[model samples]
Target: MPITTEKEQLVAELSDKLTRTKGAVLTTYSGLSVAQDTKLRRKLREAEVEYRVVKNTLTRIAAAKANITGLDKHLEGTTAIAISYTDPVAPAKVLSEFVKELKGKNLEIKAGIVEGKVIDANGVKSLASLPSREVLLAQLLAGMQSPIVGLVNVLHGTTRNLVCALEAIRKQKESA
Candidate 1:
């Protein structure tokens, strides 16, 4: 089949985005109201995630071009893709939160890809359950500093005991 230049461009764009993103969440927006969809888009945008209602065929082609597979089976139904370029869990986290807020209505996750690994709804939820990048980094930093902090406290303990003993001795001498 001869491809149109416009479609080629669209596919190229999608493939580029797909190739660059760390995670992609495939979802259905079937029964969401305009207000809810707008709110979702706003939230996703704030998170620096790209959300698009892409044609399944174009998505398939783009996925193939990007060397991403295993999500084609999930391309069925009213599919919209939420893609994150930096944070691998942002899209999943946002979508899962939104789904929960909506009471798991029309807005539902189908499948997802995180760091090139395909995952299902449960996997996406699990990913969402994880802390954000900043939080994880903070946790790592705390972990790295704990030993040093403990060592410093341990090193100070001898001086503390010495000072206490000196104070006690001084008090005893004054009493005598």
Candidate 2:
């Protein structure tokens, strides 16, 4: 069966969005008030996340077109999407925080995609809990440098001990 013209257009647009999006978080927003939705949108905007309320059918079509499988089960009940084209974790983190703030209201994380992998709700939460990009990069650098630093310190201490031992021997000989 052919979809209506408007529905087809919506599906096409959503497919485009999914295709171009670097990362995407699918959520359910059922019981949010207008004010709360506005607040959530603002927060997402601040984080450079693109927020969209999508129809489930259209979303499913888009997901299929994008070759993202097993997401149809998650496309139920007032589906919304937060897409992050630049920062993979931005939408996940912001949406997770917003849901937490609402005390787990009608907003529920369904699933997400990162680097072409389908992640479930728990996976999305874990991604949200991860440190920011800069923090992660810093930690990685520190971890990479620790062993080198330890090796350098060990070499220095050994060299210093050898020098001290030679000096002590020289002093004893001189005294003798």
Candidate 3:
């Protein structure tokens, strides 16, 4: 079948997004109310993530063009994608939280991609469980600094001990 111009445009656009996005989560948004969808979109927007309902056929073609594999099976059934260009964890984090809030009223996670690697739903959950990039960086910095801090304290203690010993000797000499 010949592809229509509009579909070609959609494929091009989705292809671009898939290639450029740092991370993306595929979800099943069936049974979601308008209000709930709006709330989810707001939260995603605040996190700087883009959420859109996608045509599975167009997305499959786009994903192929983007060199992304292992996404075909998960594209079925009321698909929407949450894409993040900056923070890899933002989409998963927001969607997971939103799902929790809904109490399983159909906003189910399907799969996700992070840094070009495709991951399953469980993997998405684990990704969501991770701290934000900033927090992880802070933790790493603290880990890197702890040894230096400990070494400094040890050096200071050694100098203080030497000074105390010297003072003790001086006091003994004065008394003698």
Candidate 4:
């Protein structure tokens, strides 16, 4: 039998989200209480992440359609996926922080797909260890600006030297 229209629609929506996502972290929310869940959702939302509890079967189909492989193994159990469309590291950071706050409760990161690469839980944590996207971009811009600043200073030094030489020559001529 074919899948129902609603199911197909859900899969399509998930697949589209997966396609547009910069990164996604899949975790099992087994023992989470309502309050903790709400707090976690709020944190993720503040970071602009989309968190969804997905049916593993439909999610598996959607992941494959989105060209994300190696996730099927991690799709088992009570799976929730956190998708970050803008900053690739936001979901990982938020999820890791929540896990730490919970003292490593039933919230377990199974796997992640970042920039089209599937990684394990350790990899996800490592990603979280990185600075935020804005910080990284600022660092890059500063690094790139350094050379330009150095060149401008070098040009100014040459002009300064020429002006000093001219001034010295004028002083000598006036004395004569």
Model number with the top lDDT = 3
Clash tally for model 2: 0
Q: Can you list the residue pairs that collide in candidate 4?
A: none
lDDT of 2: 0.89
lDDT of each: 0.93, 0.89, 0.94, 0.94
Candidate 1 structure quality by residue, lDDT tens digits, 50-118? 999999999999999999879788989899999999999999999999999999998989999988778
TM-score list, all predictions: 0.87, 0.87, 0.93, 0.93
lDDT of 1: 0.93
Clashes of 4: 0
Give one digit per residue, the lDDT tens place, for model 2 in 51-149: 988888878887898877888888777888999888889988999999899889878999998866789999999999999999999999999999999
Q: What are the per-model numbers of colliding residue pairs?
A: 0, 0, 0, 0
Candidate 4 lDDT, tens digit per residue, 34-152? 99999999999999999989999999899899998898999899999999988889999999999999999979999988987899999999999998778899999999999999999
Model 1: residue 23 alpha-carbon error in angstroms? 1.8
lDDT of 1 at 65: 95
Lowest lDDT 10-residue stretch of candidate 1: 68-77
| Span of ten consecutive residues with least summed lDDT in model 3 | 98-107
The segments of candidate 4 whose C-alpha lies over 4 angstroms from its true place after superposition are none
Report residue 106 deviation for candidate 1 (angstroms).
1.1
